[model samples]
Target: MSAHSQHNLPPSLTGKGATLALDGHDLVRMTEEHGSPLFVFSERRLRGNARALRDAAKGGHARARIFFASKACSNLHVIKALREEGLNIEVNSGGELWKALSAGFAPGEIVFNGVAKSVPEIELALGHGIQSINVDSAFELSRIAQVAAGMGKRARVTLRLVPGIGGGATAGIQTGSEKSKFGMGQAELKEALATAKANAAHLDVAGMHLHIGSQVLDLPDFLESVRFTAEQAKAIGGELGKPLQHLNLGGGYPINYVHHNPGANAGREFDYTPYTATQSAAAMLGEVAGAAAKALGPDAEIFFEPGRAVVADCALLLSRIENVKRRGALQWLFLDAGYNLLIDAAAVRWYYHMVNASRIDAAPDTEFRMVGPLCDSADCYFDVEGEYLWADLQATLTGVAGVTPEILAALKAKVVRLPETRSLPAATGPGDTIALLDTGAYTLEEMFQYCGRQRAKAVMIGTDDRIVTLRDRDRPEDLLDAAERQGIVRTVAAE
Candidate 1:
């Protein structure tokens, strides 16, 4: 009847009676020391993920390069650890570029990628001589060329082509569709290539790049994307009269998030059979070997910019239940952590498996409506939008003519996002520590300070069994420090 016996816990997590340990460190004790609403990352998992990805890439192609997408988890310690494992860095903004440099990544080991690259960001990349700037559009290409011309430097550039292929869990994350505002289409790409050739003095066309989407579960979509990119590379090389130096197959490798339990109402909408790094690499490299090799030659490198796959499952968020309420036949458990800490949960209705850390061995026979401390109604873990739509549909169809029960059931199935309830220990309530699993990626990076709640602290469990603080808990003054710096608010001391 224990939770572990019923649920598939992550590899780094183990549960015993009244205790939940992450890689042999007790979660309850850590929460007691560090306070609730904390993030704990496992160094062992981070290094393992890096090694697995690197080895997988090498298995597919000898000249493969893996770049840890730092925008996923920009904590300096995490970046340094991945770098030590022989992965380069991929950044999206000037701030991320600076973080990459501060993390000790050489300019040659970094690649800048973004849609809106300001003048200052372009200058910083050129000044440091970063490996390549992944150009998002034709206009950006001309802008980069102009900036490089002004800087008196030849900027290495890669065209981010839109393969017109789209695959992702949600529309918000889908970046490769024809309508998506991410990369250049065929006409724009042709224009970019011509512009690069024209501005040969300032722009060095190094390679081509395309990102299908994040959390893409379809392997055939990857194969199709790789095949398309390879074909384009071949034609591009022929047009330019020189082979490409690299092919940046931007990463969207998925990771398993749902841990199934027969007795629990864990949402199945987020579940997918994620491809292993090796499988993804092989699919891409296999396509590359066919046509792309004929143009780029054997020495051409293959680059992967993995973000979520590298870190999503390597950490968990620990939250404390601060209050409990019961209405009719339902129970609600409110935790201290909310959209401010894990924005995706509210923004996209993202799901993270919840575990009762305080009662690890207890049977999860009770279903509770789990919610965060945020004042907003959408702050709960359930799909708020989906629930609203379902309710509206039911009300609309209540007296509609010829609306059969079967039809209503079918409509409800399509409208409802699963796991409308959460299964937890029956005794779960106030003061209980709940561990939200697989929250490593996107949570802290997208965190915001809303409703005056201070941001939480993060700690890493080192491979050496030492717990190091990755980030300190935000102080009350830290909130106003930004306003103070901008002169929006002046502190009159000792008034």
Candidate 2:
């Protein structure tokens, strides 16, 4: 809301002075009405992203579908909203499978994915007759066969090949590499396919799939992985005497997260545009489709599983400052929420732009340390290395003896070198709200009951321009339900 300059702001945010807005609604008022430490999602943004992906596919292959990655977000309302746009779903586990079903996704529209699938979950997937079970390992392929045999069902599958490609924002999220714990190596995947083909009584190795990790910045690497997957599919189909029916070039589109990095891409600093200006979905589809036609032959149905691109910029976390402290020369700002609300930020050093919601117009002159309410030292906004967790400022409590002002300024300058830094007004204090931008994806799926901090409320600005509660804030009893099950108290747990 700064009148100084409005450049590089996200499309969903607007307003001047102390009143920053989302979908035209004042965030301060929304927080007051819904409660602080909340997640506010823009339905408009969600639909736009979904449509952009679908459009990209249609434009590229003339027949493209997005199996919306359900693990990125599990909210029923959010799921239902995206499903209504004609997008399908991809679930990583039985719990997510249930949520997808509960969200009104048809069996044929749901694709189950995971490294390990328990017997009950496998049975559940078979019972529902989901679209396809993406087999991650040879053992998992055999496990599916056993379960399907017992259930007297024919389970469709796509072998997930590890191309050993790695390019992601963090090592934790890179799934397509052999160094990662997801999917199977190419030789193992080929062997699994042969085994499945041999045991055709219960399993059908009908397709090939490969994901070259997430946060992919280099488009060429991703395309190469796609080509490799198709080539593998052709080789396997010829060896197994079967035609591959589908190919899943899994989703890994990069979103701009760095807000102030010089020479960085434009609109990355709080930019929320869903589709690329030149790199359209049609372009990506055309590239993959052409490759598949050459290697796997024509009629290779295309599929993608987009999680981050569809929802990463659709929501924000609204937190309030509980205290601002200075010890010696260090300045600190403590928020009401912790890593419990957004685990990825703390665990993997994920970057999300922060704003002083209460005073968006004020010059961000303050360089205070940022911390969360969690007693654990790991719950700060800075990286896991704890590089900027504290100021080096040291002065006598008597105020008579203090560090040199010039030295203190130099140290503060060093803190700014880290990936994320917000310049909130110097007056920021208790009750002042902070908005963590670009939090729609990954945050909800990883939220936990750490320190018994209940999950916050999530409100949505609906398509009709009306506000409604998509999910109620987690109550205290929700967290205690698990502990109470151990006979620590009377035991009627959620399960």
lDDT of 1 by residue, 1-495 (tens): 545575668668887557799999999999999998999999999999888888777766778788888889999999999999999999999999999999999998999999999999999999999999999999999999999999899999998989888877677788897788899988888899889889999999989999988888777777777788778888888888898889998888877666765665454342322322234433443454343344445688988898998899989999999999987799999999998999888777676888889888887778889999988998888877888998898999987999998888777656665457788888999999999998899877787789989899999999999999999998887787666755644445423
Candidate 2: worst 10 consecutive residues by lDDT? Answer: 265-274
Question: All candidates' TM-scores?
Answer: 0.93, 0.86
lDDT of 2 by residue, 1-495 (tens): 342253245768876457678888889888899887999999999999888778767656644568998888888989999999989999999999999999899999998988888989999999999889998889888889988888899899988888878766557778877888888886787679677877799988878788876676666776788668767877878877877878888887766664443222222122222222234333554565555445545477788887888888889999999887786665788998888988876777666667777877776655556788997987887644534343323332224355566655455444323333346677888899888888998887678888878888988899899987877888867876665746655444533
Model 1 spans with C-alpha error above 4 angstroms: 1-3, 267-297, 397-414, 482-494
> Highest lDDT, which number?
1
Which ten-residue region of model 1 has the weakest summed lDDT? 269-278
Backbone atom clashes (below 3 Å) for every candidate: 0, 4
User: What TM-score would you give candidate 1 relative to the actual structure?
Assistant: 0.93
**lDDT of candidates 1 onward, in order:** 0.84, 0.76
